[model samples]
Target: MNLTTKVNVTEEAEKLEKVLFSQKFWIDLGTTSLRIVLILIFAVLAVKIGKVIIRRLFRLKLKGPIRKSERRENTLLKLLENTISYVVYFSAILAVLTEFDIDVKGLLAGAGVLGLAVGFGAQSLVKDVITGFFILFEDQFSVGDYVKIGIAEGYVEEIGLRTTKIKSFTGEIYILPNGSIIQVVNYSLENSLAIVDVSIPFDVEVNRTEKLIEYYLTIVSQDKADFINKPKLIGAHDFTETEMIVRIIAETKPMRHYDCARLIGIGLKDYLEKEGITIPYPNLVTKSLTDV
Candidate 1:
């Protein structure tokens, strides 16, 4: 090669080597990586600390005499925890972008415009948020409530700003958008009724059956703390050719009716058997095909 060409090539190689082997460049890269790692760690710690604080604050409120509804407080606690996580992670991402020498302000500005444009097409999302806010404000339902929304019946697992989560008894989870919940039937808001029906032979006197049921209900009320008051024996709710139906109704704590009803049925059955009253059971008689 010519001398001038060789000199130019050597100068380019030296410049490339200097750029690659520079200690300052490696130090700056390491520093930037460390800062990004620290930023992420700080974000994670902030979320955890924020959650802890929220839980402690709610616990303190529960200890006070003028405490608010526990369900509402639990819902709010979860919402705040989620919000803190989202905000911290978002900030951490932006901080990391900044460390990479990207202009965060310009990115955010562009994002804002894009978000606005996207908002026009996301009407259902906006509706969901607005409806969720009203659901909280109006106290329609809260976490742990047994509710029926539309065709879904389950316990509320979470109430978020955009959606609600319900866990059914069969272990199915239903995630519903807030805007679609047109009606809600909350079974947890009031006491439940435990109704038990006892059928007796027509030969038994109605007055005697009523007296026995009344005594049995009084005993049940005394034994069980779930009963709000003594159960009433409503005489002769129905009648058939061979049997008379007697209805007993008890007021119980919410969601306690099913178990309470079963308990009452068991106790009453035992009591009636001891008193010589027999419950009738269907008798099946089978005949051979030839006999038929």
Candidate 2:
């Protein structure tokens, strides 16, 4: 309303408008955005290139006469890939912060102090790291190994500094912290046993049944590459009121027992059908009320 107040308000509006329309403001924003984008791009490229390099290095090592264990190499490759990703992304974040005019040195110093203060309370984290180290060092289990830790049973997908990844047969992934893995049952370290039970009606001649199975066992492993040796017929294992159970044992490559067992069951069923040896099935009969 007053002349002096109107002039002051107009001056403040003009100054605000000028600042908003300044070329330097838009230019600075664009520059900072472009720098951040470039930093992120470089980080992604670094991770990809690092992974390729590591895989190539492993390939070269495998080609050598004195080669390392493939399982162990796979574990190391995964660990290295994760490490490179973490480092590259962390560096990229720092570069982006610098673009925003954040003091990198001061932030890092403060983080260091904070980390130290928090370390005492982060016992599980420390334990996880230490346990992971010992696991790798002792070669308890490697990536691709079939293992059971606690209730999680599957192939090891990755072993990291703080956690282990297990991919189950059902497509579920279990992420277990390293500190909690107290007992591990690794099935990949040795051969596996596959047991198949064939049930025959008690009326069938036991000697003839055994002979047929013996002949079948001789050729069972011939087509199966995973089988370490021919399957053996362990003879009549048990007897039921209607049928007799014969057992067959197979020695197969580690983690391949499942396939081998299934193949054995199918082949034996087919063989018995072709030989006219009928597997018993319960018979049902219905009587009319007049007959009863």
Candidate 3:
């Protein structure tokens, strides 16, 4: 027999056996009725079992350690678990009602209409889903990626079916609906530029300065761990009556460009001083009337 029939039969047989036992048969019958009343209890137990399974699976996901935004994946999974439990519990109630010969056809139709009405009232909800789909497929940004959307710039905190969460550098959490995300600048996707502008004084011999810089740059570039590209002393960028400006450029690895730049700055000054090169300082000249 099925679970329902077996349960009923067991309770019935237990009651009959107890009733035939002694003078307290009526009390025993009442206790047996309470035992059969635990049908809902079993359904609740099943829900608990499902939750345990969900927890175990989620813990395994944590161990796998896939990078995602906002630590929100855990919350989303919990919400799904709750939804499943409620849905299954409602289905069980409907099954029990069917056993009592209740017609739920009208109720189902009413629920459908109500659902449609609610859906229409929440247009943003629909927009959220549509936009979220496009965002993921278009690869707008992934978890742990530094990005800027509109006025907000930070590491992507989370990407959900409805909204995106951003954690700002200033420690503010910004929640943006995917539908509202019009412009996204993802900084983590490509290489970064670390440009250093080195200024030389007018009195310093320009050729000596340039050659020394180029020589040092070649050496720096030859140092495998320190350099990225062979440093190029580009054409003179600016010429003023007092001093000239030269721009040095190098292509370096992402995020480490700053490291290369810092090294260049510190090393450049020391190298120039050791070569007896002078850094120009601002000098103002005044003419006296008598001298003129």
Please write out the lDDT profile of model 2 over residues 238-276, one tens digit for every residue.
888888887778778887887888887888878877888
Q: What are the lDDT scores of the predictions, listed in order?
A: 0.82, 0.83, 0.72
Off by over 4 Å in 2: 1-69, 73-118, 280-292
lDDT of 1 by residue, 14-60 (tens): 99999889999899989999998999999999999999999998898
Give lDDT for model 3. 0.72
**How many backbone clashes can be found in candidate 2?**
0
Q: After superposition, how far is residue 100 of candidate 1 from its true place, in Å?
A: 2.6
What are the per-residue Cα lDDT tens digits for candidate 3 across 1-292?
Answer: 8999999999999988977886787666675555545546776888888888888877777778584433355554566577678887887677666545578777688889998998899989989988986776556677777788998888988888799999997899989999898888776655555455677878888898999989988887675653446867774777778878777766665344567776666688788888998654312122111122
Cα deviation of 278, candidate 1, in Å: 6.3
Q: Each model's TM-score?
A: 0.72, 0.60, 0.55
C-alpha-based local distance difference test score of model 1:
0.82
With candidate 1 superimposed using the best TM-score fit, by how many Å does residue 28's alpha carbon deviate from the native?
3.7
At residue 272, what lDDT does model 1 achieve?
79
Query: Which candidate number maximizes lDDT?
Result: 2
Model 2 clashing residue pairs (backbone): none
